[model samples]
Target chain A: MIAITIQQGRLFDPANQLDVITDLHINHGRIIAIGEAPADFTASKVIDAKDMLVIPGLIDLSTRLGEPGLEHFTTIARETKAAVAGGITSLCAMPDTDPVNDTFAVTELIQRRARQAETAYVLPVGALTKGLKGEALSEMVAMHREGCVAFSQANQPVVNTQTLFNAFDYAATHKLLVMMRPIDAYLGKDGVAHRGAISSALGLPDIPSAAETLALARLLLLAEETGVRLHLSQISTARAVEMIHDAQARGLPVTADVAIHNLHLTEFDVADFASFMHVQPPLRSQRDRDALRAGVKAGVISAICSDHTPLMHDDKLLPFPESVPGISGLESLLPLLLALVREHILTLEQAIKAVTHQPASLLGINRGSLQVGAPADIAIVDLETDWLFNRRQLMSAGDNTPFHKWPFTGKVHTTLFQGRVVHQPKLA
Target chain B: MFGYPGLSSPSLQLNEAGKLKHLLTLEGLKPHHIQDILDRADGFINTDTRQIHKQPLLKGKTIVNLFFEASTRTRTTFEIAEKSLGADVINLNVATSATKKGESLLDTIYNLEAMQADMFVVRHAKSGAAHFFAHHVAPHVHVLNAGDGRHAHPTQALLDAYTIRHFKGADFSQLRVAIVGDILHSRVARSQIQVLNLLETEEIRLVGPKTLLPHDASAMGAHCFTDIEAGLKDVDVVITLRMQNERMSSARLPSEQEYFETYGITEERLKLAMPDAIVMHPGPINRGVEIASTVADGPQSVILDQVTFGIAVRMSVMAGIMQT
Candidate 1:
């Protein structure tokens, strides 16, 4: 492979607080030199990155790449391609796959598939329990050795207190990062949308804020007692944000991420009972949305994720409640986050950190940085390009997104994975 | 804060001219909209009482009763309403329809539309099912929600409004109305509140156990009361809801007897209301669970009247949409 040099672009590397105009040299799939390069360095290929903002590749904390089971909805190759196009160079593939990734073999299968796809890095998260039934714990140690970045029950809540305690105990011993999507199973029972005036009027069964807060409080305490490294995913309520902040202030080894949709949308978005707006730990009130944004600003919420669960078209064609929960989020993730910066809710640096260094640091991964000798994972973004989001233009199989036809002001121009150009816009 | 205007149902339910295109929910309905439906229903009430007659207003139209969920009363009333208006009516038991044969709801809708149906009366167990139909149906066609899960039952609200206007007078601003029992699972209660609020009613109270009340029940322009007596105090009307049996299995209520003992509208509880107060129920009454036999059978009980008004209100709604 020829060495590549990216020239004269404004760079923003959140990991080291480096923001300046610079040139980067890459060789052997690593960033060989930045700024003043070695005298012997010569680039065989050059990428003119003028008029772009180069940053460390975005890292999503959670994503659903339906592979090894749900190939009809999505596959690792398709989803990772979409992810890279949206500026995500790496993502934690949720363990809630078919024949759940609770064992070393399943984790290894994901690794092999991601390698074969050559789209982007896939960090397989091992299931916290066998079959994710909340019964016996999975072989965490063995799965971790096989390259599972973290362990989670995915969207399913662990109903048994003892089961959760046991899993936390084991994870604590191993110093493993246990990611959880906190929800009180009973409180959210069969509920389709947020409990509010809108839900009441729409007559949809509602999942209340209490459901998230109560479950989050319990999990926070459990993490406190177990001394486990907890990374909470996709928290939706204001109270949940407050709880996570207080826990972190008390020095508990806990970090949390809010989904991008939660910050940009709310229960009002689901007012017409649009099936695309349906999501687990359902879209909440406006107050909660503002609080979540504040949490992100205060640095209490360390990252923002796609929570990118995709579904087939028919899956959303049924009645709202009967439809599956999730949004096809990967393709829209970057534009939506950039929208926050455009709207002045977040600064450019803050938005970059939320997707890059913050999430990478939470997972204890060293990839979301622009350090010399680091893997050349990078994204060049056009900060002021306006585009329309249409599902037909998406790479993933799932065309189910609430943001269809939404006008966005920022976009990813090109992405590189391990020094290889994986996704770039086609010439007009 | 989540009050994004585009998130509401009115935009989907009404046309650009603010006319009802589809009756999805009673929310966002103006005072005149409710008055127009009630006045049209009043004319029907007079005609039905005066003579055996049929109107040719909807004579050329074809109405389809697309019931995905069973509701003998709602379906029968809609059928009667369509037939009385002289429209051809078809009742489909969608439980055994092409939907069960692996057909999607939109596909089923398209097939019926191909048959030249002009209107659809949709009843589904999921909330927003009717709204879904309205969005996908042909622009010339209209949708009327018989009931959709815990969402609005607009015709039920209209009839309740008609029943109140017929007995207690058209002005609801000075009227105090109390809706008792299972407010959480009652689409009737949700729709009723929307209508009552639009009418600018003086007070609307929701009475139920905390477990059976929606979290934001008070936000629907009703005061929430745990005690039946407190909610019924000097109110001019009472609307009781059927205790949904399915909710009991989910443990929302302890037992039918237990629910009746705590929240049921007995004669003793009725005395707490005003002397001329009327009683209403959108029934197949759970005789013991939601109300006592004497109260349900009493002179003040307009429960049967609500059923009568249901047909007229549904007819008025269908006629209104066709006119649009």
Candidate 2:
């Protein structure tokens, strides 16, 4: 009944106790065992993975694939290919699409497209309002039944406190995880970038660290009061980490994730006003980046996400603050995160877990763990391989990243989505 | 070419994103570049002290203050700083000139360009008139918008922020700043709120008679406060505007005496602020109409200092923009 098999690989399987060295058996698209298998273990084919690192495929809890409505940024084909390039097997897309994902029809359409793309799976988050207009609640129950992963209105916040509290209560009653972007909209109005010495000196648009942290504080309190499961996306500022830490310590229903861009870079990158680095929350200060690293090291932010809203080059390639809100995360997610491992900030295992198992737990997906009975959706990565990133080679329809031509390591050599190689780049 | 220590030569920026670029008004910009111009003017200032001054980095570039708006305070002070910066000076109120041609702005601009104008310091009563010139002129030309038709008076607002930062310190996340009077017609208050919100200043309030303050004031990131005493309550800085006589017929707001009695800044009304809170006015104050003389000339008022900083700040912006 089974077909695929892999041999001789340094396995860092946290879910099983197999550390650094082992073999995995695959049969009928499931991991049959780890360690050297007996002679009777039959397979149609066996590939040697003598010096590779096999980890559970990564999942981005709150990802942005600008498609369906805004296909100019990225279509499903390019985004899924970008996801596989970064070793991400699944991505939970934001609900803030055109016409907004407020109903069952939108969520199902995303899944249907994912199946056709033949790459990463897309779990859609239905909008919490009639049209994400923040006026009234959409049917969380019916959408959840239609395979909506959670009720999410990601980047746009529920401005009125009453409207937000109501969304939380309805989500709690329906046992749905509600994801929030967490910015005090009134304070965030003229703010085009994170406020700091650079922003002060330039006389450019600025948003204080308080704009983000304050809304997080309000959401944490609301979660404590309403008993709703809350997920905070793109925790950018150091102050936000402290607030979320306190929320988690008090056992509030708040789980948070950090964007790779926020953790690895800061406003200094935008000093030349390189439109590529001109992102929303406009890259934090260096001190904030250090704090975020320490936050991840200390486990305050339990997951690492891409916050990957793809914008076409026409939207980017402008002056510093006027460029769009995000960088293409799916393509660079692995290399950038691996840079953290190479920098000694995170162990390779720790790095893999953040993008993989940790986000899996946050998204409540059954994937992202390499257990004996789990589906054999493994990413075979060559940890020591080096490659150059050409913007032209990127699969995402969006070609907007500051690291357009940077050299990178830790490339995914072969990716098995469901025990079949879906993506394979020529080995150097 | 002009030179200042640490600042580069007076470089003309063909691209809107170039450093030291002037963003006086958006007239000649490529539609591809208009939003880029608005995007650059978004930075906040941090000045240390109760009386804010300006950065001295633009010291060598000349900034002529060519204001036709009859005002001694803003004019003389900017002239003072141009001299301080070791730059040549000229203050021409072109109100007597051919500006009334409905003369295309560049005709006036070309006459000045012939005079080796590095920076054309301009002020007109019409909104977007400066932007019109900024766009029509060559990239080598730079314009300073002193005050334009209810469009923007950016430098004034910069000085207000500098003064606020000097007095209130770096955190505006919780401080309440009330900008009262003639909101619909005053570009000074309008620009001030834009800069304040960009700095993420909390509790910014706009107070005026309903006829003076437009319904859209709230979108500008300020609570539209109608009651004077209530709006001024517990505020840190209160900026009052001089009543524009030209708008009297159309304003249809309160009469001068009634306005002073209703929305005017008074010593009694001053009690509603945090003690030691400073008062500001972009003057020729409407002496007894929009504000009582006692508070206009009160102990806490930094009205004159605001004037001094205005010249220095305008020179800084003029020189910096000219350099770009």
The candidates' DockQ values read 0.59, 0.04
lDDT of 2 by residue, A290-408 (tens): 99888888888878888787776546533344446677778788888888999899877677778877777777877888887787778888888888877788777777787877888
Model 1 pairs whose backbones collide: A203-B150, A203-B151
lDDT of each: 0.87, 0.72
Q: What's the distance in Å from true for residue A77, model 2?
A: 2.3
TM-score of chain B of 2: 0.81
- Poorly placed runs, candidate 2 (over 4 Å): A38-42, B1-324
Candidate 1, which CAPRI tier? medium
Query: Compared with the true structure, what per-residue lDDT tens digits does model 1 show for residues A1-428?
Result: 66888898788898888888889888889999889778988898888888889988889988989887997657899899989988899999999899899999999999999999998999999999999999999999999999998999997889899999999999999989999988887886878889887787677888888988888988998998899899998999998888888888888878999899999988888887788999887888999999999999999999999988878777888778888889888888889988898899999888889999889888888888998988899999887788899988988778889999999987888899999889888999
Candidate 2: deviation at residue A45, Å? 4.0
TM-scores of the models, in the order given: 0.96, 0.63
Q: Write the per-residue lDDT of candidate 1 for residues B71-109, one digit (tens) a residue.
A: 788888888888889999999978835573213678889
